[model samples]
Target: MEGELQRRVGRNLRAYRQERGLSQEAFADVLDVHRTYMGGLERGERNLTLRSLEKLAAQLELDPLELLTERRER
Candidate 1:
């Protein structure tokens, strides 16, 4: 369950970032995080804290819950 949630967050983050036309390195710069750390997050290899999640959401102009919620296919 934990791993699944991590992957979900990763997928959502990647999708949202792509939607904004940002590369992982650029997004990491916007978030003031390391590029490697951003890569880890996008790969679902790192666990995210609530505060970090909120920060990421805020940077993306998204509600924090949106990061955790599963996106439906069109």
Candidate 2:
């Protein structure tokens, strides 16, 4: 279940980033994380801490809940 949440968050994060015209490498740079690490997050292979989530949300100009939202059609 946790893994599933990761995937959902990752998918949403990717969408949000792309919508803002940011590449994974560029976003990673903004987050001060390695590009590979950013990829892992986008692929749902890495878990993010609350601090990381907050930072990312700040960068994206969104609320943290926006990142966690599971927008996939049921």
Candidate 3:
């Protein structure tokens, strides 16, 4: 379940980044994370902590719940 959730969150992050037309480097800067870490996050290879999620949502202008949910952009 954790793996699946991670994958979904990774997909959501990629989708949101694409929607905003931001490169991973730019997005990592905005999120205050290393580019490699962001890559891992997007690849579902890392388990993000709650604090990490909060920080990411704050940077991304999204609610925390948005990160927890997986829905294709409309």
The local lDDT score (0 to 100) that residue 21 gets in candidate 1 is 96
Q: Which portions of model 1 miss their true places by more than 4 Å?
A: none
Q: Per-residue alpha-carbon lDDT of model 1 for 1-74, expressed as tens digits? A: 65998899999988888987999999899888999999999999999999999999998889999999999864
Index of the highest-lDDT prediction: 1
Q: Which residue pairs clash in candidate 1?
A: none
Residue-level lDDT of model 2, residues 1-74, one tens digit each, is 65997887789878876877999999888778899988999999988899888988887788999888886643
lDDT of each: 0.91, 0.84, 0.86
Candidate 3 residue-wise lDDT, 3-74, digit = tens = 988887788888888888999998888788899998999999989899888888888899988987988558
Among these predictions, the greatest TM-score belongs to 1
Please report, as a residue range, the 10-residue window in candidate 2 with the lowest summed lDDT. Answer: 65-74
Candidate 3: lDDT over CA atoms? Answer: 0.86
- Candidate ordering by TM-score (highest first): 1, 3, 2
